[model samples]
Target: MNFESDRIWLYAGEDTITNRGVLVKVKEVLKPRRLRFGWFSKTGWSWLFGSIIGVFLEDFIEGIIKETWLVIVVGIAFGLIFVVWVFWAMNIQTKRYSLIILKRRHEQESFWKRNKDKIIVALIASLISGILGVGGTLLIQLLTKM
Candidate 1:
């Protein structure tokens, strides 16, 4: 058995979520910046689960069912169900999204700015909890001392 190694030069790739600039190596400075996996998350769960089950699942299920028309019907039913579920889920999921996107203006607002009121309430709750914990400890100490 023989092992081979290849020499590679570092090239810049754009940041996905933030749309930020990438680091360029000295050798790559003159070359145009390249985008690799620009749209997809590297090492995301979809990739992991797809690798494990996605590629062969349709064939495997078809083999079990063993009817062409049934397979088509099942596929259509699954597709319809998936579409409906996604449509339903979008509302619930978007409601919980940390950042808000204004569709008309095409502006993304940070969660912190939009929910300042919630942040203030959370801060007050934490402060009250801390005070109560300290006061309770002090009272327990006083009772034990008597």
Candidate 2:
């Protein structure tokens, strides 16, 4: 009786293991190392500095409002709502990014390890632009005066 020879499977070296996957894992592991710093650089500094300047601005604006109470009241109400909206929008974006990271972790997919820097830079640029857009518009209005 002639027995059929069993086929042997040959696995390739490191290339078979997916470099993308490895890169993703590496990026994930390195995230926390710079995440806080990145966030501090992105929003923390601006928020802190803005708050300091805002306190003085608020006092100045308060005086103006006291003199024109009716207009000031309306402005304050609108301003408060706008501030809430901005924070809520930021929270939503942050949560979206968090979810993306979680998904990549679960899928074991390459986590943009190669593009982490670019991803962060892009994200930061968008945030800065939003801030500048809002601030610039307000500043222009303030400068124009009635």
By TM-score, the best candidate is 1
Each prediction's Cα RMSD?
Answer: 19.5, 18.6
lDDT of each: 0.52, 0.57
Tens digit of per-residue lDDT, candidate 2, span 1-146: 11111111223346645765765665565445333323333455456656754665665587585787765665566567556655654664355232224443566746597689999999999999999999999999999996
Model 2, which residues run further than 4 Å from truth?
Answer: 1-17, 21-50, 57-66, 69-82, 89-146
**lDDT score, residue 35, model 2?**
35
- Worst window of 10 by summed lDDT in candidate 1: 1-10
Query: In model 1, where do residues sit more than 4 Å from their true spots?
Result: 1-106
Tens digit per residue, CA lDDT, model 1, 97-129: 223222433374577888999999999999999
Q: Relative to the unseen true structure, what is the C-alpha lDDT of residue 1 in candidate 1, on a scale of 0 to 100?
A: 14
Worst 10 residues of 2 by lDDT: 1-10
True-structure lDDT of candidate 2: 0.57
